[model samples]
Target chain A: MSMIKTDKLIYEYAKLDDEGNVIGTNRAIDAVDLEVEPGQFVAILGHNGSGKSTLAKQLNAILTPTEGTVWVAGRNTKEPENIWDVRQSAGMVFQNPDNQIIGTVVEEDVGFGPENLGVPTDEIWTRVEESLKKVGMIEYRHHSPNKLSGGQKQRVAIAGVIAMRPQCIVLDEPTAMLDPNGRKEVLRTVEELRKKEKVTVILITHYMEEVVGADRVIVMDKGSIVMEGSPKRIFSRVEELKKYRLDVPQATLLAYELQKKGVKLPDGILSTEELVEALCQLN
Target chain B: MSIKLENINYVYSEGTAYRKQALKDVSIEIPHGQFVGIIGHTGSGKSTLIQHLNGLIKATDGVYYFNGENVYADGYNMKSLRNQVGLVFQYPEHQLFEIDVLSDVCFGPKNQGLSKEECEKRAREALEAVGFPGKFYSQSPFDLSGGQKRRVAIAGVLAMRPKVLVLDEPTAGLDPAGRDEILDQIAKLHKESGMTVILVSHSMEDIAKYVDRIIVMNQGSKLFDGTPKEVFSHYKELENVGLAAPQVTYIMHALKERGFRVDTSVTTIDEAVEEIAKVL
Candidate 1:
């Protein structure tokens, strides 16, 4: 069975008037049927207000579907009792580290999630240690979260989520506010966590470079899934992506531009290494 | 009017055991009507330096001059200095709180004690400058989309009519199209008004495309300051400071290493395409 399954998910919310009267509804997620097997790393790319984040919120029961259903680890999120089960099975990390981190210290923050789940005190400490190690943040376990850099803080946030022992993790642009080095550090940490823990990852981001290595790429636009394929297949269609107001990696764009100039080049050049190898094949 | 700093230093928690020096012996000059990009790793004093430009933070040491007047001098009019230098912090959308877009944009000028009619007129013009629709002027800022909200926040600053505009990572979380639109608007504003523009960003590609000059900060000090070509040429130095040149520059360098005679200085995609086409 798939780790995450959504059947024709449609999310709509009422737009309230000044006195709290429902004026109209806005459809944020429209008929998106998605599936992810265990241990899969899926990247979701979309422009702002495209409902990618709304879909992520559904996975962890942050927002139940206005229509249709969402299942996490075989449990339906719409059912009230299964809310805790679904959330524990699928943890979430949001964009800003400052807003998400609540604990005074790094280890304390990681312990909050598992602690709320009513795990034994001794087991919570063990899980915290293991999660911190998985993210390579064990060295700073005692430091205050505020003192840590943006990258380190984000890693701590990830550890906090994984400490709950979730099977799937949904990150909503966790690295959007980070610098380049911070972004690299967070991405590397997530990759390492996926390998060590074998947790499913759904990363929603605007950065095209980060999506190039994903197991699959899902492009969303206007609350609908517009394209879904492997990174190679999706990035190959430069024109389609541009029409959606999305961009490819620098190497991919450069290769595309070179190809347009009548120089023979392969499509979907995702990285500098691949581009270099392709260029060396000519002349 | 130009902004000049000499040996500026800022210390956090001075006189305490945990005192940290956020900026150290930093000095630079931004002439009037210049488009400059500032880049560095986080905590490299980029934010702290920009905060000083508008007199938001007093330097612990060294001197700062705006239009030949010392900003820290006794009896100096800091309010006027602030009115001349406008700053839009990172994630500027968080700063918006007005009931509507036009009122939000009018907040800055209104606070400056401008007449209500003047504030509204400036707000309308600023909204137009940012390409925000006139219909949205009456809508709540919270109801707008992310890109629209960001534009409204920027319009808040533009309404002040500052001579020098400093944007701190104006496109931090915007999508590719939103990023392009915002940057394009800023560039147009700079060209049309000839106002000083200082943009702080992490994306080297953005720096290469728009700014004429680049400033690199490292370890709380001014590391490099020059034209985009001059600054990016030291790719090694940039990497040492936890930064990279534009990806095209690296690509061109790799091609050159493989005996291809492409111009390694090419920073943008179009420039690299042309340079590689020449060799091919």
Candidate 2:
């Protein structure tokens, strides 16, 4: 069974007036279909207010679809009885680390998720230790979350999600607020977590560079899936992505520009190594 | 007119065990109407340095002179100084609170004691400079898109008609097109009005493309200050400080490493394309 499956999902919310009257309805997520297999790393890219967050909220039952259906691990998100099972199967991490972290101490924050799930005390400690180690934040387990850097705090946030033992993880712009180094650190941790825990990963981000490593990339525009393919396949059409107000990786842009200048380089050169190799072949 | 800082030191939470030194003996000079980019890792004193420019935060130690006057001196007229130097914080849109976009932009000029008519005229000009449509003047800032909201916030600062504008990651959280739109407007403002532009950003590509000068901050001190070509040449030093040159710089270096005779000093995409075309 697919780890996550959305069948023609449509999410709409009432546009409210100052008097709390529903004046109109804004369709945040239009009819969209998606499927993600277990242990697969998928990336969702879109501009702000493009309904990427709305789609992510659906997977964890944070927001049920207004029409159609969303299923996580064969449990429908709209079913009230299945909400707990759905949430257990998929965990979410948001952009701001400051808002997500609740515990004063690092390890304590990671343990909160499991504790709320009614896990035993000793088991919570074990999961906390394991999750911290997975994200390479074990050394700072006892340290205060307030003192941690943006990257470190984000790592602790990811550890908190992992401690819940979810089958899949959905990160909605987890590194959006971080510096380049912090972003690199968080991406590396997420990659490492996928390798160790074998959890299905769904990352929604605006940074085109981060999407390069994903097994598949899904592009959304106006609440619908406009493109879905491997990173290379998607980034190859630079002009199409640009039309959606998205960017390609730096190397990809250089190669594209070079190609426009009539240099015979291959398409979708995702990294510096590939671009260098293509340029060197010209000689 | 120039802004000068000499031996500036800022200590956070002083007289305590957890006291931290945010800025350490940093000195720099900004000539009038010059565009400068400041790049640094998080907590490397970038914010502290920019805050000093507009007199938002006084240095715990050292002298900061604005246009030959010591701003720290008593009766320095800081209100007028702030009017002269506008500082736009990151995600500036969050500060917008007025009911309508035009009023939001007019808030700064109104606060500066301009007449109602003068405030509206200045706000309209500022909005035009930021490419905000006149049709949206009466619309609530909350009803605008993210990019539009950001531009509206920037217009608020510009409405004050400051000689120097310091933006802290003005393009943060904006889409690629939105980023270009904001930067282009700032560049246009600098070109047409000859206003000083100081952009604090993490994206080296932006710095390389827009700024005439680059200032690198590391560990609470000035690491390097020079033209983009001179500063980015020391890529290894940048990497050591948890920062890096633009991705194209690294790609150029990779080409050189691969025995291709290409200049690694190319920072922007156009320059890199030109150099690579010459080689090909």
Candidate 3:
């Protein structure tokens, strides 16, 4: 069974008038279908207002679909009885670490989720330690979150989610507010979580380079899935991605420009090393 | 006209147990009409340093001069200095709270004791400068897209008619095209109006493409200050401080190592493409 599946999900919110009356509806997510297998790493790319965030909200049941259905861990998100199980199965990490972290101490923040889940005191501590260790933040367990760097705080946010032992994780532009190193740290932690914990990963981001390592990439535009494929395959269509207000990785773009200038380079070069190798072989 | 900071030091929570020096003996001189980029890791004092520019935060120890006038002098008018040196905070969209976009932009100039018509005139000009559509002038700022909201926020600052503009990560949450659009507009603004621009960002690619000079900050001190080509040449040292050159720089360096005669100092893609084509 898929860890997450959305069948023609449609989400619409009421557009209001100046006097607060509902004038009409704006369809934020329009008839989208998506499926994520267990332990798979998926990246969703889109410009702002592209409905990527709305789709992520559906997986965690933050917003029940106006039409169609979303299933998490084989349970329908729209069913009130399954809401707890659905949320438990798919934990969400938002863009701002400062907003998500609420505890004074690092370990306490990580334990918040498990504690709220009604886990025993001893079990909560064990899960906290394990999750922190997994995210490489165990050394800062007792430190105040106020003093931690942006990367450290974000890792602690991830640890908080993992301590709940969700089968999947949905991160909504998690690195948007971070610096370059902080972004790298968060990406590494997510990759490590996918490898060591075998949790399904769905990352929504605007950064093209960050999604290069994703197993699969889904491009969203104007509240619909416009393109979907492996990262290399999707990136090969650089022009199309640009039409949706998205971009390919810098290396991919450089290679494409070189190809346009008649340099006989291969399509969809994803990294600096790959571009360097391709250029060197063009003798 | 120039902005100068000499031996600036900023210590947070001084004399407390959590005392920490955020800026350490840092000195910088930014002349009028120059585009400068400040690159640093989080907690490296980038924010604190900019806060000192508009007198939002006073330095613990330093001398600051704004166009030959001592900003720290007794009876210095900080409000006028702030108007002349506009600071746009990170996620600037959060600062937008007006009922409509135009009025939101007018708030700054209106605060400067301008008449209502003059405020709207300045606001409209600022909005147009940022390339914001005039059709959306009456739309609620809350109804705008993230990138659009960001532009309105910037327009609000620009409405003040500041000579020097300092932006802190203006493209933090924007998409690729959105980022490029904002940066391009800023570049055009710099070229056309000759306003001094101080941009703080994490993307080395953007800094490499836009700024004439780059200032690398680490551990609350200025680590490097030079042209894009000169600063990015120290890519390895930058990496040691949790920063890096643009991806093109790395590609050029790697090609150089592979026996290709490429200029490793090329930081932008256009330069790299031209250099690689020559070598090939």
Give one digit per residue, the lDDT tens place, for model 3 in B33-139: 99999999999999999999999999999999999899999999999999999999999999899899999999999999999999999999999999999999999
Give the per-residue lDDT digits (tens) of candidate 1, residues B1-280: 7999999999999999879999999989988999999999989999999999999999999999999999999999999999999999998999899898888998999999999999999999998988889988999999998999999999999999999999999998899999999999999999999999999999999999999999999989989999998999999999878789988899989888989988788889999888888887
Tens-place lDDT per residue, model 1, A1-283, is 8999999999998899999999999999999999999999999999999999999999999999999989999999999999999999999999999999999989999999999999999999999999999888999999989888889899999999999999999999998988888888899988987897788999999999999889999999999999999999999999999889899999999999989889899888899889988999996
Q: List the residue pairs that clash in candidate 1.
A: none
Sorted by lDDT, highest first, which candidate order results?
3, 1, 2
TM-score leaderboard ranking: 3, 2, 1
For each candidate, the DockQ is 0.82, 0.72, 0.86
Predicted model with the maximum lDDT: 3
Candidate 1: which stretches are off by over 4 Å? none
DockQ, candidate no. 3: 0.86
- Candidate 2 residue-wise lDDT, A1-283, digit = tens: 9999999999998988879899999998999999999999999988877889999999999999999999999999999999888888899999889999999999999999999999999999999999999999999999999988889999999999989999999999898778778888999998987897799999998788899999999999999999999999999999998888899999999999988888888887999889888888888
Looking at model 3 chain B, report the run of 10 residues with the lowest lDDT sum: B271-280
TM-score: model 1 vs. ground truth: 0.98
**Candidate number of the best DockQ:** 3
RMSD of each: 1.2, 1.1, 0.9
User: TM per model?
Assistant: 0.98, 0.98, 0.99
